[model samples]
Target: MFKKFLAIFTLTFSLINVALADQANPQVVMKTNLGDIKLELYPEKAPITVKNFLDYVDNGFYEGTIFHRTIAGFMIQGGGFTQDLERKEVRDPIKNESANGLSNLQGTISMARTNFPDSATSQFFINAVNNYNLDARGRRPGYAVFGKVTDGLDLVVRISRSPTAPKGGHRNVPQQAVIIEKIERLGSESKAN
Candidate 1:
């Protein structure tokens, strides 16, 4: 009877640990027409940015969005415009978290903002190559790096390589819009190994 009780306690402890581990750093899966892009967000590093992004995902704000801008060898930007070039309303811009010690390296995802440093809303970009210029340094306010693509990087490349043209005064718009089907928080079991 003592052995049985010990086994039950051990199993319960293991399950609780797993749940806590998954909650610490969340994972998200972004399904696009091109392919599935899995991301591992760093809430510990960029807490505000990660929270904003996850809130957007949870609210279904990324559904039916398109990759509006894709610059080969640079990055692919999306999560703001629709397939018909219509801009969607987003929450107020969050504070700049560029000094979070995260670099805009290849496969890393960063927020896309206007000239204002703290004007990042729902738009984000995935770096196709090392983009050191986007990293905060000295007095420069660089884009905030919050997460990275753990899978479907080749799909990101494919979308970046797609034909682009000017549309609705927006340059580098993909001719064939790569629509974002949906983005959701990945289950703990689905996290990247």
Candidate 2:
């Protein structure tokens, strides 16, 4: 009986550890010229989206991209280009996890996709308003919202309100583009003084 009880305890402990790891793996930081925007990724909720974003971060794919699209009261997008509008080649597209229960609410981060559902690559956006209409259940499959801005909504708002410059391109073209400059990760271990 004691052996059986020990085995059950070990299984329960292992499950708990997995849950904690999932929660801990979601934290991320976005450093921009405007300011630093800290995000908490939801790999458990949207594994594909999280993996795509983290892959870019890990490979330094977003190092010099610019926020090509910024619409006040709508969203701010980046992670795809340089100040001169040069596209940074990214890995093949990722599966759209829009079916995930997350919403495209204000301050939430979502993947930028084409007409198709599974076309999201390296580009992403943050909603400046509660965009329930963009949720997956809408007529369109909707953008894959994988995370949210946890501590820098003000920075996002500021970027959204910045003046835009006219540019010829595809979706969310800002009249005046905001350059991303770079993206870096900040964890507790790195913060130790």
Candidate with the greatest lDDT versus the true structure: 1
Clash count, one per candidate: 0, 5
Estimate the TM-score for candidate 2: 0.81
Candidate 1 scores a C-alpha RMSD against the true structure in Å of: 6.1
* TM-score of each predicted structure versus truth: 0.85, 0.81
Model 1 residue 97 distance off true place after TM-score fit, in angstroms:
0.4
lDDT of each residue in 1-193, candidate 1, tens digit only: 9999999999999999987865667888999877899998998889999999988888889999999999999999999998888999999999999999999999999999999999999999999999999999989999999999889899988888889999999999999879999998877524222
Candidate 1 positional error at 56, Å: 0.7
Candidate 2 lDDT score relative to the true structure: 0.81
Candidate 2's displacement at residue 188, Å, is 5.9
- RMSD values for the candidates in order, in angstroms, are 6.1, 6.1
Q: Which stretches of candidate 1 lie over 4 Å from their true place?
A: 1-23, 188-193
lDDT of 2 by residue, 83-154 (tens): 778888778998888888889999999999888888889999999889898888855688899988889999
RMSD of 2: 6.1
| lDDT score at residue 98, model 1, on the 0-100 scale | 96
